[model samples]
Target: MTTNQPGHTFQVDLRGLVDLLSHHLYSSPRVYLRELMQNAVDAITARRALDPEAPARITIRTGVGGGITVQDSGVGLTEADVHTFLATIGRSSKRTADGDLDLAEARADFIGQFGIGLLACFVVADEILVVSRSAKTPGAPAVEWRGRSDGTYAIRTLPAGTVTEPGTTVTLTPRADGSQWLEPGTVLQLARHFGSLLRYEVAVVDRHGEATRVNDTPPVWERAYRSPLARREALAAYGKATFDFTPLDTIDLDIPLVGLKGVAFVLPTPAHPTKRSGHRVHLKGMLLSDQATELLPDWAFFAACVVDTTGLRPTASREALYADETLAAVRDAIGERIRQWLTGLAASDLALLRRFLDVHHLAVKALARYDDELLALLLPWLPFETTDGTVSLDEFCRSHPVVLVTQTVEEFRQVSSIAAAAGLGVINGGYVYDRELVHRLPQVRPGTTVTDLDPETVTAHLDSVDPGTELAAAPFLARARAVADRLGADVALRSFQPVGVPAMLVDNREARHDRRRAELSAGADDLWAGILNSLSSSAPRAQLILNHLNPLIRRLAELAGTADPQLTETAVEALYGQALLLSRRPLRPSDHALLNRSFLGLLDFATQAAGAPAADNGTKDPR
Candidate 1:
């Protein structure tokens, strides 16, 4: 049989709750100081609502025995008020009994939303004592409420004149493990970190009875934007103080619709694209977090930003801002501000633009991928390596309307000298984003055609041999081709400028890979050799171009008719090896063996011409 059970309320394990708050809810035990200061600020704000002339001051004192006292001259609590607000967890007294006050409006004036601000102190302390006399309850005796972390609490009426003025004083007797936080220096540091920009004055009292104001009245960012000159100077000073480096430029950001105002500082040093930019963020004039990365777009890594917003809400721990639609809008607004600053610099200040490009061109290039306007302005200023030297894109285009680009630095290096000698300008597209940018140039700027110049295409622009020269070198070319066939290359006689070069090695991507794979499989066993041979069967063959204008090549062409076959073959191998070395291609074991044999044959020929005795067993004779 089923019976209906009576409904019952769940009782909270107070110790367990305190442990959770201490270990998990709050980010750190040091945040207890921030929680206390927030409560004090909220109390002061409430007091101002009642009497605008009330002193808005918070004082923190570190006691010698083992406790800390935070006193605020704000709206305090009466005996009944303490029982209702302090005794009950999560019950905030920032509202009235009528429940007419809206939570959002209260958030505008008050910092403490959850009444658990006091319970946050339980992370470091075991007992909390509060003595307060409300400003509304004038002439009423002060009340004292004491509470322990173990779910026990008491309240009683204090003697009259206990508090000469309306205010609240909270004293925390720390647990044995948390005694380090009771030091005056630690207390002062924590107070300044969270309350440095608070509107009200905050003071830390040392044991000598001297109080030092720990916060500035108005933050530097808030005061600096009054004038352009002042903003520049203030940003310079702030950048040095915060990042320990001078900023390149300052970008002023103001999105009143989102209640955001701050400056984005352009970093002087180059920032890697993958690095996370740490931005200091504040909520309602109080420091929230120093590492708020999500507040800016990912591409804005080149800037370090500091912002204060009344529009964005912090998570429960207050260590980071909530990621929501409002935050997304704010992030875009901040990014747009930075984008405007960059484009403005590009339009008006060429000298400054050059300086920025010198240090941060990579960052600008990253942005230019998506921003056409920026790309348009930055294109002429960006530099690229050309056959002549490093020159701006505008200069390169002025000389050669049809741009020819090599895809890598090595490829450019291999042909740059020869191309320059031939009066052709080839751009080095090896740097970051250069190749992609070159490819996009046609779409961005009309009437511009960018051609990728590989080894094969480059040869077409070289000088070609006349019919007479080709007929004279035909026999030599046939012999050279027969020798090069063993190396998987074809040989041709071509006349080119820079007649001192004997030969040039030209190959397309497929040909280069084929040659490399053929070299790798030369000594492999049957299985591996067959696999590589199959893969390389479709590889394009390389061309070995002989410079017919060079005297050595012309002599070799004549020697092909009467010289010994071994001597002519050695000369051909030597030319091929020299060309390979000039192209910077790695040599295989077979190529090295051929090179050794050719060198030894040439040495023996020289020895015979000198009328010296032949070395025995191919060893050099000691004369």
Candidate 2:
């Protein structure tokens, strides 16, 4: 095992590697400017370490025929440094002790990093030329490195005055298709887009010989304003400019441990609860990403944010954050900041908080479902649809001893008007997050009684008709029961308030499930029919409650006893059909056809009666 033979290094395909970087490693070729800026900023940081008063400046100029020259006043490289860093891939001297690049990367200082950054220029350029004069060795000769995309490089010591300053100038000769990205307008935009927040004097010089400075001031969130109103207006304006919509409010985000600072602008309009929130994020004052979605909690989709952090880690492409414990901690910390914003609203800004709830109550309800503190603070102000009318939960709870809730809007609508007359408190829990939030009502209020509504329970509270009246109506009741049987329902006589309503559809959850199963079984194949049939229940389906107090029903009953049977049958069927339609439930296909047939039959009967002469006995059917 002690052979003294020469070792051979693996040769790399530079073209293939560049293709990989362009297609997979980086999001787009636009990141070439970011890589160059990162190198320049790190070099300046190194120079600052050597001399505290060193100038930290970076300048970019677009040369003739679509070439880009980036010059930085930083600590340049020696000949050996050029050979080691520029000539090798995935190799750098800026690593930490023990050479481990873990989640805690060593990028806080001006030390150089992974050699892949310079190679990213190959994504756009065919060749890269670098001229540098070392700051470490003031008397040493400057070095020039010319690297091409064909896996070849040349480094040499340049004579005096070739590079007069102790810094580096990198020039890129773009490929045929990269000329657009190398133009003066594009170069200036890319420079400002990626380095507008860098902690240095950065500027872009165009072909017109004019220089426009970038990163000239701090971020808007970090600046001081004259008054609170002015600060609010400025933040709103910034949000509108950045996100294209003015924010309803702004929440300051700070995590000292990670050196993360941000402003989360609460979106003004309703935001989808499931859609991800993409927040703008900057790493070490450099624009890292505009759509970093992992920095906030899922429930915080109601915000669009701009953040800058010095401690978070970026991926190799410098496009997104590295998912690690630090990122998790940062996400949790941001969630805590948002929670504080909501709690602050509850304590001091009641009107504004109510407005927020009106627009984003679904988001709050999602948060409240698991957060005990938030549940207590927001439960009183959250609105719900109840028999008493749409009002806050606190208002509904104070008036009703027992709270009745329906799992579907149809179920609530079927009995809402009637329930109100019966002194029942029924709330619609059909909306997203509403049922879960209501089920947790007891956690917020100790004595709150919450139960799912059963239509049968509502039916039981209805007043019972006297035995004499029931007996007198026996003929009509018998006919009505037979008619209801064909429709898969049971008929009953009840007396309720506001007798204008002729009949009500009271459908229980179990009956609804059974009806759905029955409908499926009718269309299913033999095997599926058997399976569905077994799952169905023997419980009765939707009930048809005929209001005995309604004048129309009373007249119909009288006709049922004395008039022709055909007339009574048509009246009973029409009453049940009207009730079913009012429930707002989807009608079965067979039911729809039956309704159509009945209307046609009625039209035929009316036409015959209209054309025929007046009855000799001066009497007509009450249909």
Candidate 3:
């Protein structure tokens, strides 16, 4: 058993352990430099704690031989301290005496930890040498520890010229493959990415003696909210910085849900990050999440807020988050905050809110259908039909003669068109218009159907139709019917006499009969489906309800019984198809062709009657 040689000492190389930590634990090799620098910074922080007036800066130096030095005037370590801190891996001050730290349940504080940071050095170095003296024991001899990961380490008293100051100076000799770490650009990039937010200033020194600080630690998001600027200013700023900010979506909550604080920023449309949506969530002045879309429902994705909550479960990597009681409370709080803020925006900034809806109206309308609780807050920003252009739902209800809210966007369009045609200005209730909601709201005027009409077409129709006391009915009905036939559907003639046009399309489904049928089969009812199927089976027909008393209808009926009945029919058909086309209905090609042919023949007949002699071949008018 006497295998040991006399006067011999065993020495171990520590590179293997360092390699495991530096290469295995961290994502990359460059992180080793960051970790060492971070440790130097921490040392200085400790020194400052002991001596508050200590200089708050970290210095770096590099040598062409691939030797890197990190120095700090912070807390240093004695021989015993170094042995404990470096010798025992995975040990940090963040842990309790029992070595139990509830990282998941802890409040959000980014200490930049995980004990393996020191081992990161092996990523670029074959050997590490440190010289340090604890600020608490400035007179104590500084310590030196040297080793590779092979087996054991060598702890010895500092050599004569090893250290002259009370701080840390860690020198790393680069491995052949790791020489690239000494490059100035590589070093600067690492500082910017990981240590940008360090409280103390950090500077990188290059081989040529040049130095650079790559970070501006305090970004604007760290600032508190200021008084909101004018709409134009806010809008312009929002457009310029939308990429760096969260989207501002509004919500209405009856009460606060969690302890979250934030400033509202109305962001620009088409933000860079789709999830740049929602509030920029934070904790302890540090960003927790950018979108925070998960905390709120999909409808709330439009808000750009800075939601700062103290409660969160931030993982060690600082890249992911998890929900706990604290996070839940925060989520609920944010929801309520958004709701309240939206309500305020409606009251104080109604016009701006309306402008937002003009583009995001679809999202709002969808919410209106599903989120009645928020309807009160959203209604003000909704768009309604107006003579000047579309107005806000609030403005529409206030200025227009009639205000109506529907369950779906399509339904709202239909009702508004009817009202507009009757010269009874109308507004869209909110964002949504559900066909099923016809029962909840008052029926649009009897005999006046709210037919679907695109805004552009509506404008054109109003421009072309002469404004009169009563509309002409018979000829208009015949024309409307012909178009409806081409579209493979029937257009019901409105009994109401609107001043703007000779004929107005009516929403048959909005009538009492339609409502009754809808109610009878509320659960997965096939009645409407059946109606569509039936309509599809037959040749398109339009219900030509005769406004017998209207001047236009009377004239057309009188003309029907005369020798020129064919010409009268042709005229009615042309007008009807034109109206249907404006309503966005599809016309059957054959029916359209028939109407076209009839109109051409009538044109020829009219030519003969106008004293423009007929063809000499004696081809009678095709009619």
Model 3 — which ten-residue stretch has the worst lDDT? 436-445
Q: Which runs of model 1 end up more than 4 angstroms from their true locations?
A: 1-7, 11-27, 92-104, 224-227, 407-414, 430-432, 442-446, 465-507, 511-537, 542-623
Candidate 1 or 3, higher TM-score? 1
Winning model by lDDT:
2
Q: In model 2, which regions exceed 4 Å deviation? A: 1-6, 96-106, 110-113, 471-476, 562-571, 612-623
Per-residue lDDT over 262-373 for candidate 3, one digit per residue giving the tens place of the 0 to 100 score: 4455554633323536445544334444545566545555555544444456554333356577666655666557556656767798676666777565545556655555
Error of 2 at 573 (Å): 3.9
Scored by Cα lDDT, where does model 3 land?
0.53
Better of 1 and 3 by lDDT: 1
The C-alpha lDDT values of all candidates are 0.81, 0.84, 0.53
For residue 516, give model 1's deviation from the true position in Å: 7.9
**Across residues 422-471, which tens digit of lDDT does each residue of candidate 1 receive?**
77778888787888887777776678789988877778777788898788
Relative to the unseen true structure, what is the C-alpha lDDT of residue 6 in candidate 2, on a scale of 0 to 100? Answer: 94
